[model samples]
Every structure is written in C-alpha cells, then in structure tokens.
Target chain A: MTAKLELRNVTKAYGKTTVIKNLSLLVEEGEFFVILGPSGTGKSTLLKLIVGIEQPTSGQVLIDGKDVTAMPPNRRNLAMVFQNYALYPNMNVFNNIAFPLKMHHSGNITQKVREVAEKLNISEILGKRVNQISGGQQQRVALARAMVRNPAMFLLDEPLSNLDARVRFSARSELKRLQQDLKQTFVFVTHDQKEAEALGDRVAVLNQGQFQQIAPYKELYEEPATAWVGDFVGDFPMNFVDGKGFRPEWANIGSGPYSIIIDSSESFGDIYYVFGRTESGEHIVLKSPKLLSIGSQLKFSVTRFKEFRDTPQSTVGNV
Target chain B: MVSEYNNPRNRKFYFIIAIIFVIVTLIPMYVLIIIAFAVPSQTVAAYYPPLFPSQFTLSNFIGAFSGYSSILQAAFIKSLITATIVGALAVALGFHASYGLSKMSNRMSALIISVLFFSTMIPSLTIAIPISVSFLKLGLYDSALGLALAQELVVLPMTVFMITGTLQSLPKQLELQARVDGAGFMQSLYTVILPLAKPGIFAAFLLSWMMSWDEFTFAVILSPVHPTLPILIYIDSTARGNILFASAFALLVTIPVIIITLVLSKFIKGNYLTSGVTG
Candidate 1:
C-alpha cells in the first residue's frame, strides 16, 4: 500500500552543527521522489529523518496525515534499504526476505518470500547465505525484504551505489519499474544527478543542509533555482559571467562576441568539450563540434542564461 | 636474498627453534603430569626426580577425590558450577553493557572501557578482603552465586573490552536495517545482533570460565569454608605437603579447559570479528 509522506518544517541538528536546516517536503502517494545532493550534503540525514531513525530537532513528520515524528522506526512502519544492503549475514536469502513478515506475524511467509524472490529473479539463490550471493543479488534480496512487507513507503539510501557500472544501469531501471508496478511512494537519496534524473518524478537538489531547488529533473537542469544548483546539477558546473549563469551547451563556440583562450579539450566522439579562460579570467566550458587546439583563442555566444544575485530575492527565471 | 633465508638449512634451523620453543613452554605441564602419575614412594623419596614418572598410578587422583571426607570432590564441583555461572553471567552482562557502550560516542565509550580496564590493574588481593567483608555482611561469602558475582570483577572488564570490539566490527547498518524491518529493540538484538556476535561472546565466556575456574584469591578469602578447587589444592598441598595429590588435582582442573578449547576451536577459527560484515 502507498502513503503520502510529509515533513512540516523539519530541522535536524547535532549540538552546535545543524546537519539539516528547516526543511519541508511532500511526496504524493505513489510518486518517486529523489533527494539529489553531493556527499556530506545531508542527503542521507534527510532519509534518516523521514524513516524516523533520527529525530528532527523541530518539526512534524506526517505519514498519510498522521504525525509520526515521535514514533520509533518500527512503529512508523516504513522500510529502508541501506546503501550497503545490510542483509543479515547470518541468514539465508529466504530467511532474510522472510524476516520482516515474521516480525509482523504475517502468515504464508514461504509463499510471500517466493513471490518477491521470483519477481527479483533471486528465487534460485533463496537457499544461499547472503555472503554467498553476488552484489547484484544481495541488492535484490534487500529490495525483496523491503517489498515483502508492502510498507507505507520505501526509503532507499544510495542502494545502487555499490554496484558496478553496467549492473547499476540495469538495477536503476529495475528499481524504477518496481516502483511503477507497485505504485508505492519511494523517497530515494543519492549523490548522483544522473540517477536522480533517471528515476525521480521530482528531484530535490540539496546543498548545505537546505534544498536549493525542488522540481522535475529537466527543469532543474535547464533552470536551476540558484547558482549552486546550476553548478551541481549537470556534468559540468554551469559557467558564470558577470553574475549570470549558463549551461555549457547554451554557449556556442567558434563564432561569437565573447572570446576565450582554449586551455584544453575533451572529446566525446561526436563533439568536444572545450575548457578555456575568458579575457576577464573567468573559467568557461563550451561545447565544440571540432577539436580545439590548446592556447588558441575562441569566441562564444550565450544563447540563454539566468541572472543570480547575492540576495535570495533575485529573479531566477531564464532570460 | 629472500630465497637464501628460505634454504633447507635455514628451514631446519627454524624447525629446531620451534621445537625448542614448544618444549620450553610445555616443560612445566609435562613435569606436572609426570609428578601426578608417579607413585608416592617414588615422588617423596627421590632427591632429584626423573623427567618421566618412574611408576604410573591413578592413586593420587583417586586419593584426592576419595580421601579425608572428599573435600576435593566437593570443591571440584563448586569450582565447576561457579565457573560455568560466571561464564554465562559475564557474557550476558558484558554483551548488553558493550552494546550500550557501542552506541555512545567513541571517545566516551573508550573512556569508560579504559576505566573498566583500570579496575583490573588492582591486584585481586587488595579488593578480596574488602569484598569478602562485604560478602560476609551480605551472607554471600561462601555461596557460589557470590563467588560468581565476585569473579565478575576479574572477567567483566575483559569481556566488555572483547565484546565491544566484536560489536564495533559489525556494521551498524545491519542493526538499523533490522529495526526498519519491523523488529523492535530486543527483537533485533536477539535476532540479528546476538547471532552475528556469537564468536566474540563465546570467546569472552570461555575466557571468563577459565579465569574463574583457576581463581584463588577471592575463592580462598570468600569461600574458605566451602573452598573452590584451587583453594582446596592450596590448602591440601600446604597443610599436608601432598605434591602428588596437588598435581593430580591441578591436572583435573585443566581437563575442562582443554575440552572446551577443543570444542570451541571452530568459533575461534571463524575470525568473525574481522569478517562478519561482508558486502
């Protein structure tokens, strides 16, 4: 079953240092919400707060309109998959999946575990110890353990981070499919913007214990709400000139008003990413169709950009 | 150069050194066995005793268990029961205490553990009198329960230190995952933490048991009337100069230790502390 989750002005601090500032969020009953931020940006802390592992310093955590802020993690009835899977090393795959159901005294554990195991394609390994399984299979067992209970929501903390590149790619799609098929609320936390874009119905970009922007991944990439979000959300940090920020693709190289001396370039098969410094000494990266020689000057034109300001009240829309 | 050190000549030299080390360590135990098996006439009359027993007999062991109201038999049972209880209590109490400490800040927990370790530095004799006085006042001086509790002072520090290491080695995420999986605190502890920490807990138990089994100072002072095996051995050997009987009793004390070690060698070899949390 799915449940809408809401945090009303949650702020979590440990003594003198605040790990999460006053923040609020809402996830629709069946939406896949991703919290995307770099490491040490309180992304994991946010998930812990929502899952009731760490209490918020000041705020109410409401699940389906009921306050659960003071409830213990078990009482909150939410499932979480840790970054490391955290499968019971003492139990086999079958028992690991059956643990949650047994905790709730849910009958028919054998059939339930088999069903979820089959769905995850891990039925064959049900008799194997967790340590005997591959990382990919362990991840599936963690998911199977989570899904068996059909909790109100699922909170994932970088669950795909430990997988190899190819496995991670497949696991990401499998996770998205699982969420869609179940239609359950999933709040996933990770440092990878690519994963956020791939899975999130709405991505909240966090920085310095606060959210910089909460919007769709496309909106975040095209029109980041703040300079920090612009710098963080893309493969290349957005280039800023004279208090205005623009993505690398927004600047056309080799024939424009602004001039820069090429420092280096990286090729990506069809195109090159040229890195250089402008006349005013601002570092800029621009996309180039041809290889650009180092030390050669190039001109670029900004097709679109957003103006930023020292104060938070500055207009943030694209110009 | 490395291969030169690994030559057959050097290898033989190392083999000889290992044999010498083993002999040096085992000499006292070997002599104890020889003395235990030697006939009373051979042991008492000989000025410089032979390395091996001149004659073998079970009379010393039988005499200790059956002679003079059988004090050794009663004391043997007392020591076994007390040690087993102490082993269990130490593990039970130590694991809980260590789990609580493990949740604290590393510096805070380390400070507490160091304080616990310092308690062991004081000779048991210093506290034995005060403890026996307290035990007398509480009517627990000669009781096995009291002896077991008193022995906790000897074993609890080491137990906590060891189990704390074991608990810390396990990933904290597993416990958290158990909680999130709908298990309550005690439930998760029993279902996840306890099983994963078995090796360390058993090791701590075994150490406590052996320590209590051979403990003398507290047993002599607190339970003088009933007397643990070590105390009985002390009294018999000194009061009667029964070297043969004492050696037999000493050998009897090591039997359980040996059997326990053999049985739990599997757990010791598991190396669970280092490898418990695999990805």
Candidate 2:
C-alpha cells in the first residue's frame, strides 16, 4: 500500500535555464517527507516529477527501486492534491470522490466512496455540488478523492494554502493524522516553514534547485548544514557577525566582552528581541528577558556560535 | 439616477421608444405569419393589402405540402439531415481542435484562431464553384453529405472560437487531477473537460445547426437538384411567385431553430466555469 520513492540525479531544465539541478533524493515508505523552499525554487516542479506529471531532463525516477521515469501519471499509481483542489465542477461531492473508483472500473464504488467520506468527515456534503461547498469542505473532498483510490503514495502541492488561517491549522493536523493512519508515503511540498516543521517527519530545505539540508526539523534548526538553511529554517534570520553565526536565543544581551548601541527592540510578552549595532557596524539580534529601550547601550555575549568561512559560498562548520 | 429614469415624462418616453422598437423588429415576422395563415384571396388585395386577414385558414400551409411534387416534404427532410450532420461534425472536430489549441501559448493560439477567422471572411461564393466541381469529381454532388461538408466552412470557425474559449477558461489542473486519479487522456476529457464545456458546446451546436439550415450559397451551388429548405423556398417564391406558400415554407424552416433554442436555453445559462477553481 505504500512505496519508497527515489530520484537519481534528476535534472530538469526549461530552455537553457535549469530549474532542478541534478537533484537526488529518497523518501522511505510511510515517511512524511516535506520539501521546503521559497517561491519559484522549483518546489512544485519536484512534486510533479515525483508524481510523473513531469519528466526529468536527464535522470531516472524510481518508486520502490523500480524505474518509473517513463510511466504516465495514472500508471504510476500516485495521487496528487493540487493547491486549488481541482474538484470536477459538473459533479456533486459524492461523484467527485467516486471519480477515481469509476476510472479504475472498481466495483462497490458507492460503499468505497462512503467509507472515505466518513473518514474525511465529508459524508454530510456528499450530495452537495462542488461549487456549493466552502473552501475547507472542498479541501476535504479533494483529500477524500485522493484517499479513495488507496494510492501508492499521496503527493500534496500546497494543499493547505487555500484554506483560511483558522481552517488551515485544523487541516494541517488532520493531514498529519491521515498520513499516519494510512501509513502511506506522502511527499508534501510547501514554502511555509511552520507548516514544514509541524508536518514533516524529515524536512528537506531546497534552494536554487538544490537541497541545502535534509534532516529532522529539530536538527535542521539546531545545526543547519548551511548558513542559508539556518536563516530559512527559523522564524528570524540567524545573526552572523565577524565570521560567527548564532541564533537569537544563543546570544545574551546583559553583559559580555562585546557591546552594542541598541537601535530598536520588539517585546513579545515577557521576552524581548533587541536589534543593535556593534562599534564595527556589525548588526546583531539578541533575545532578552527584560525589555530594553531604543538608543540604549548594551553588552552582549554569544553562548555558542558556528564559525562560517568568509567566502561567498559559506557552508556551516567551515572554521 | 433611478428617480430620473423612473420620472413620469421619461417613463412615457421610454415606453413609446420600446413599443416602436418592438413593432419595428416584429413587423416582418408578423406579416409572414399573416400571409402564411391567410387565404390566397386575402393575401392579394389589389393595391391596399389588409394588415389583418378577413378570415384565417390553413389553406396556404396545406397547399405547401401538396403543391410542387411534394418537394417541400423532401426538402424539409434534406435540410434537417444536413443541418444535423453539420452540427455534429462541427462540434466533434471543433472540440478536439480547440482542446489542442487551448494548450498552446496564448500568442500561438491567437495567431491560429485569427487565421481560421480570416478563412471565414473569404466569401463562400468565391469558392463555391471550385467546391462544387470537386464534389462532382468525387461523385458527391447533390447529396446531403456534400451540402453538410460545404456548410462546415460557414460554421467551423465560430464553433472553434467558442469552444476554445470554454476549454481555455477551465483550469488545466482538473485534467491533470483526473489523470492522477487513474484516467487516460480520453477518459479525462469525457469525465471532466466535456461536462464542464457542455454549455459552450451546446451553444456552438445550435448556432451551427441554424446556420446550416439557412445557408443559401453552398446549398444553391453544391446541391441544386436535392435542394435544401432555403432553396425550396427560393424556387417556389421566384418561379411560381407563390408568396403564400413561400411564407408557409419559411415559417416551417424556423420551427426547428426555435424548438432547439428553447430546449437548450437552460444548458447555456450560468455555465460553471469559475465555480470549481478557487481564485
């Protein structure tokens, strides 16, 4: 029911500009692998390649160690939930969910559809038309349609992005629980770091068509493999000064050898983030328990820092 | 603004204009009905023909069926078959062609559509002679199929334009989703694309049918012997100068168009192009 997916040196290019640069990856069976990247970084393109909607310019795509690069999307036995959900406008919700079963000529379509609808909590809306449902209901219907087929894996391309904030939070948890319940491989793609952290068993940070780091979200946060990964993985950009990189929480603002003139500060309840400049014009952000005013002098010390080389292509631990 | 438009004087003026517009547009149709239902004697009132007939009878309509070797019955059947063939051919060919066109870049598809439109602008009479010659050589002259193929020149361009717009407005994701749901290309088209495009396709079919039903140049040149309804009306009116019979034949020609339009009006209303895809 689940598959282990592999991409071997896959390179995709449009005209002369390459969008995916010789990328190789493996997603284990029943793993929730999240591809996290900013917009236009080929996140969705990678998903399409895995779903067989797109072919890699040069390399092979393998599912369960079997080459499937030449297979069509339907033959690949993968289901994809697009950002807009893409429900059939002409059909009611029941028919929309029953579409895949009908396509496969599977018997007991009504029973199968009812089971999936019950699991997705969309049984009440089965008779409603797609246009008559709200955005959240539409998303559930899309998921039910995908699930009804018992696909080898589910490929989700920003599936939660269209839902409102209130619904998105619940949808996120439901998606994670659904993946766990099915025990099916899921390749989820998103640009939101928080969503990546919340749902990914292992998040792969992609930038400029290459994976900067692929590890557990906690490891990606504590020990990022690249300076860009560190900045991209957290809420705030990691502070780098004098060839030393430290997270905001890793630096203390009370007293130490280094001193700075506070330029600005923002308070979040009991804690504060102070933005300051050193005498050598190095900008640093440090977390403080007490709120500090602007234009004030403060001393800070870095409890721990990663030394990055001064070269333009700075990788982590290049001391 | 609403009050000004609804003022008593302005209301009266608008009412008079509306009445004049309706009367101006409906006068020819009204006269046609009057002549068709009136007896021959009432239709020929010397110098001052009466607007309304003194007596109504089905004599003119009855005369159309019995007069002229039963040509009206034959021509009516021929026109129906020819128009039905043309409508089917245009929709079948246009839907597929437009699907392919919709996948191309906007500039590319536009260039091709404009070329198709340019082909339509060339007068059909200019090519009618050549087509008739080819049809004769192919041994298809004076046949319903030949007439239908010739009328395709008049209807295909509009069908392609309309169906292309409908297909283009649909999100490509639906088809892609269908494929992911274990469907082949043809399956996705029928299951997803065709249903969404029903309204446009029906509208295009209706227009094609009406155009083919009324087409004169191709019908006259290509199938003069096996004349369509329009040709039958022309022959009866010109040679026999039977205004009453011609009016009855013309009225018969409009029956199918009216019925088809009424039956398909519900399909054309509120086409659900934007509902499935979120903004």
* Best model number under DockQ: 2
Per-model TM against the reference: 0.92, 0.90
lDDT of 1: 0.87
lDDT string for model 2 (A217-238, tens) is 9888898887778767787767
| 10 residues in a row with least lDDT, candidate 1 chain A | A310-319
Query: Which regions of candidate 2 fall more than 4 Å away from where they truly are?
Result: A259-264, A267-269, A276-283, A310-319, B1-27, B34-59, B62-69
In angstroms, give how far residue B245 of model 2 lies from its true place.
2.6
DockQ, every prediction: 0.54, 0.70
Candidate whose TM-score is highest:
1
Provide the DockQ value for model 1.
Answer: 0.54
lDDT of 1 by residue, B1-279 (tens): 578668999999999999999999898888788778877656666887666665889988778777744676788889999999999999999999999999988899999999998878999899989998898899988999999998899899999999998898888888888889999999999999998898898899889999999998889888889999898778778988887788888888789899998887678654433221344
- Steric clash pairs (candidate 2): none
Against the native chain B, each candidate's TM-score is: 0.88, 0.89
Candidate 2 CAPRI-style tier: medium
Report the lDDT of model 2 for residue A77: 88
